[model samples]
Target: MPSLRMFGRDWKVAVDDLAVYAGVAGLWHVVWVIVEIVFLARATAESDQPCIDSEIHLFTWYMSVDIVCFLLYALLLFYTLRGSILDVGARKPAIYILYGISAIYTFLLVINIAASVLKNQFVAPCQDAHRERLALAIFICHWIFWGVWALAALLAFDPFATTSVEQRYAARLWLLKCCSAGASEARPGAAEHIGEICDRAYSTQDEKMESSTPMSQIGALMTLVFTGVDMTTTDYATALILVRNAQRMDREDALAAGVGKPEVAPIPLDMLEDAAHYLPHALSIYGWASNVLNKQDIAAWGCGASCVAPCTGKDVHVGDNMLFSSKNMTIQGVKVMTKSNPETDLLYMSWDNEIQGLLPYYICIDRPRREVIISVRGSLSAADWMTDLLVLPVEVDANFLGCDPSSMVAPEDVKIETTASRRRLISAHKGMLGCAKTIAADLRRHKVLDAVLKSDQHAREALKHDIYKQDCSDHQLVVVGHSLGAGVAALLALHLRSVYPGTRCWAYAPPGGLMSPELSAAMRDYCTSVVCGRDLVPRLSLSNMEILARQMIECSARCKQPKVRVILHPGKKWKRDDLFKPEAEMSADARKTLEAYMRNSGSSHCAGGKVIEARDFLTPGKLLYYEANDSDIADALVFTPQFVDNKEFAKNGMLISTFAVDMHMPWMYQMAVDKALDDAHRGLPSTRVEVAKLEGTCYAPEAAAQTTQQAETDIEAAGGRPS
Candidate 1:
């Protein structure tokens, strides 16, 4: 038995000590149960009831079970202490029985607390209400006492032997079981290195030291004191087992020399310039879409009628920039569409429209750039997240795009022998597809696309700008958005391409599960997607989530030991406060798990059915992955923007980094683009190594010049340019 001396007092804990603690807890429970019973009996007698009904009797039964389980646990611990169960093998059954009783007692206590709270909340106004309040307090006290006892027992008994040599044996047995189960056999050379890998799985500073870190000790203390033992010893045991299993999986790939790197192309200088130019507008529109400021301010800023009241002066300046400062560009009206009222088109003139299902978009004309730009806002509300998750694949058709289904070629031989060569594409994510349809319908209903194409009198009236007076038909149509809006923008561009040829899309951090590979590949001619470092949104797809789930399950299944122990014998120094020191690394496990997941994800497979292949769902268009370069420059870090292959983009899994979510922010993308441009001007190498250059007319400056020249020639041929 282990013993410790604290505050000049000997503290010795054994099975008998645990038994005595259980007995004390059982007596405390009996006292509360008796008080509750007496109070209930008095209330029933006052109500003129013959006896307690089944509903009221439930409390009685629950209290009885709690008392019985605690007493039974105490009895079993005493028997073990007395050596009645001398053999270790035989004693195992008694220990399991004790754990089982504890589990039941913990469960009943939870139920009792919940019932007491409910009773207190719904109790009718009566003289006996105070009695119910008293009972609730008693239940809470019982819970707190049990939590403290459980924590003390955990420290005293060391039931799971986590610090002893038994843990190493347990880790080894787990690895062996996994190997025997064929996990090790799946990868070559894993079996030969099993011993070395198992050693690493359980290796620590000292075998006899407690595995609990100072931070974990603080967390445990907070959980015990504030949350009242929400997680039991069994829960902690299960967590430890899962962690050990993941370590084993990580170690299995430890010996691999290198991971295959995907080939990457440097982002074209012209494209990088375009992305940087439009990023501000893309970010600013989110503020407009949120409808948080004064309507006058929104209208003054060229974004239609604000949906809500004015915010404070401080809120208005938050992320506010000179969105409409460019003299060459004219601000057109914004179109705010929602599913609730599809019939009503909310614009600069409309007011007080419910913001539900709101998808706000605005169109602008840039004379210098010769472009008609439509910008959509990203997710900023609960409704938007709901849209993001609605990723069921829907087949692409004219009806799906808000067009007459009858017009799109009689639904005949949709399949062809040259499947890869077929021009027609299949499906898209339902959420983004719906958003696209909404935007398309609104554009058509208001003749917005016509306005961009012709720039005639109606165009001027529709856009509320005189810039339409200039034959703006020559200007290229560009669609831009960030995050959820990015996905919607991509889909909208695809649908609008046929009506307005040369339509281009700039999508920043679009959803990873937006469209089929065929559509994604086909869109490369027009759409350009920008992904910042470790942005989880672009990698979060249903397939990837399923893969992550499977990995967790596989890791859990590989472990055999589901118990953990705590060491209370402070090895040398008696510094009681040492248990609460801050940890040096908080997210190390998360980082490791993310790394292992990404490494093994390529080999994992999803269930096959009528469902679309996980490989088929990918981010649309030409992908530009923007990442920071590890340079020797002391002043500032250089960011390199590369056009990576679609396969590389598809292989990206959701990041579990501490900064993963932060990386997805619009400012992060903007900053990276800005840095890349700055680096380009400074004559620094944009990319470390480049494999190939992408040939495309989308981002090429010459393409815009040629289109402008062609429009001029056509106008002259038709008998002179428009006045």
Candidate 2:
């Protein structure tokens, strides 16, 4: 017989162990049952009511017998069963049955004691069944015996990797927790080789030395190392068609004077026809989907991947219609298994959790097309992260960069430096530059300071590896983000354009001044930005906000509060408020701390690459209040008031707040392609297409489409169709 030891080389999961434990528990219950029967009968004979109520007495007998037989059956099965416990399919079901039987028996036992007391209530006191305390203990003992049997059965089966789903979720969960707790303790080169660490965490039986890394020290670097991919995935051809000949914002000071273009770039015809005119409806996916983020208000871990739950368009509202969720949203042909991280969107925004670092965003692979979509969630519903992003420097520090290649720190040194230098460096630096050090320290730990400074990470390398493992072809990555996520996507695209393959970015309603002239020129060939007409988001200049920040800083200094103030929103003029406003007000000390960062970081915020403008897509269905009188109702205006001057927009609807926010909706920005196309085809002169300027040899579908359109017009004039 095998030794009954629980550990040290000889510990094996065996059916014999189950047999031994169950047999002991069954024997205990059987003996208890025999004692209970004798006590019950003897007590009944001594009672003034010679027979206890037959129904209650019979129930007691049945329950005792059923329990003893149930244990006996379990013992027999364990002794007779063969092969590995992991191979057994009925184990989990059987264990659940045992648990249910125990619960029912316990409930009935309580009733048996209650019924015995009631029947003897009218009888003499000397022979009361309730007074027989010693006899009741035996029944109580048997009830506990059944509980023991259930527990034994539980350990006998494997719950991690079941027959139906082979994934060991518990192992993965533990791995995520451990790695998140202390990612730096992991060995050198661990960032590039996370699969090996995962294997160690998954296998409890492996005695290998490599698997010895404690669960809490799982490769946490994986969270920081892969950072994110760089691409927006919007078409450049359509962007060119919309903004080619459209007026450009030449005056940098125009935004400062509260001047904006209400009749901004319109969607082009080619893209409108691309989606079969369902472009506006399709665009709501971002706005509506973003609204689905379940922020939990937890610090650092505020937003998680929990919002990843499948979205159906049933609940979303868009112009008395619903988005075609079932039709257009199957990025994958069918639902694929994803790691379930069930938490609120707020908790996912956590920057603090080690187990779940940065919410562990997904790289969703479309199996058919072999395309990988890296989804980065936008700001949480609450303004916490938006505020943090403000305090947190927008650009990486220049001092932390350019470590000499020849004098590079060793991989082991990086792990050491992350732990030691992080706190010291943060303390040494003050304000935004200091805060920037803390961020730099995190990057230093993962040895990706250079990568993150450039918004480029090992995302492509890891993505390619995942594809190879899945036996999929190597292709380009498509990145899509909204609001804050759009800015991140653009930053990612700028650095990866020359380095990575198939680099395309589709920034939807991205913020203004985020683009620098160099980056704008660099990404022009491939990056396409879609902006809703008069949507204040893309029109919001960083210059105005910077001026506000400086004023707040100096105001604090004058008030003997040396503390500077930090607030990021349009300065009262063109003031618009809505969800994801990214507005905030902070102390002067905070303001001064981030002052250098504000000065050096993105000074301008405008659409990069080719800009596609959607005209009044977000404008309300019909004006709530119209300008024309009832006498001339036909031309009463079909949309909201188009205020060209920024100050004019602010005056109406409690200042242009309505006009500024009205067009920024994701559903509105979604139709830029269609609106531009409609505008081009609206009338004779409107039929003119904008021709784009090119610096490199790039294909222009607009040029070809125009040539064809002009030829067809000539044919139509001659009474002939050019088809």
Number of the predicted model whose TM-score against the real structure is largest? 1
In model 1, the Cα lDDT at residue 253 comes to 41
lDDT of 2 by residue, 255-331 (tens): 34554321222223343342223222222223324323222111222211223222220223322222223212221
- Each candidate structure's TM-score, on Cα atoms with residue i matched to residue i, is 0.49, 0.30
After TM-score superposition, what is the CA distance of residue 410 in candidate 2 from its true location, in Å?
Answer: 35
Candidate 1 collision pairs: none
Give the Cα-based TM-score of candidate 1 against the true structure: 0.49
Give stretches of model 2 more than 4 Å off. Answer: 1-361, 366-370, 383-468, 471-474, 546-655, 671-723
Number of the top lDDT candidate: 1
Q: Write the per-residue lDDT of candidate 1 for residues 597-677, one digit (tens) a residue.
A: 344333121112112333358888877778643232322444667555554455534444334577787656867888888
